[model samples]
Target: MIRTATPADVPVIHTLIRELAAYEKASEEARADEKQLREALFGERPAAFAHLAVDDESGEPVGFALWFLNFSTWRGVHGIYLEDLYVRPEARGGGHGRALLTELARICVERGYERLEWSVLNWNRPAIGFYESLGARPQDEWTVYRLTDGALAALGSGR
Candidate 1:
């Protein structure tokens, strides 16, 4: 029971995001606002999309995957970059995570995308093993960098 998420699901999605952060031991960092989520997903131009997985019997959402498209200039093709994927603790081992990823892979293949990629915390051994078992290899040679907080503002101001 997996389906694309609608704007109505924003609250549930936000709750799940908090849950994910808590699971990752970064609950304080989960500061997503529901209104902003709605605007992002259902605005004039959406920035991202989400898919929800629900319980077969109860019809209650059990997990979600948020993703967006990315362009690979070298490959001259588009790719899917998964931003977040999370399943409830009680729903662990139920195949929801794999199903979500499988759907994303299908989307990539069907659309002729070059890749489906996401990042995982190095300390999450279980998640790393799960992704490896799915034939996802880490891009160990590439280093990730970010510009945020004061640095991002300073750059924006050309200071």
Candidate 2:
């Protein structure tokens, strides 16, 4: 069963995030804590949104999709940029990932948005295949870039 996440789901969401980092072989990079998630998701001004996939019987969370909105100047519309999507390893084949993505796509269509996008690591063939099966095509012409840590700090501080 898929449902919108509540503030009560923050702990489980944080755990899932760490689990996802570990699965991606970069556990050390998962630095977010429950407090940050609470503020970001449910604070006075929310910055992001999440949806949870729960066990139909137990109502325990199995997966989640965390996303935020980005405006495309060319399209003159807002689109969802999914930051993370994960289903517990034990629940992998049960269609939770697809459900999560489907919900996001539904949101895009309902809101008249032009895109729902996310990135998958180049080495994750299984995820790539799953996305392809869902009719999502890669933007191969584009290369992603990031400025983080020292580079981000230097640029922000004009050092």
Name the top TM-score candidate: 2
lDDT for 45 (candidate 1): 96
- Model 2 earns a TM-score of 0.98
Which runs in model 1 stand beyond 4 Å of their true positions?
Answer: none
Per-residue CA lDDT of model 2 for 1-159, tens digit only, reads: 899999999999999999999999999989999999999999999999999999888889999999999999999999999999999989999989999999999999999989999999999999999999999999999999999899999999999
Q: Rate the local accuracy (lDDT) of all candidates.
A: 0.94, 0.96
Candidate 2 deviant stretches above 4 angstroms: none
TM-score of 1: 0.97
lDDT of 2 at 115: 92
Residue-pair clashes, model 1: 0
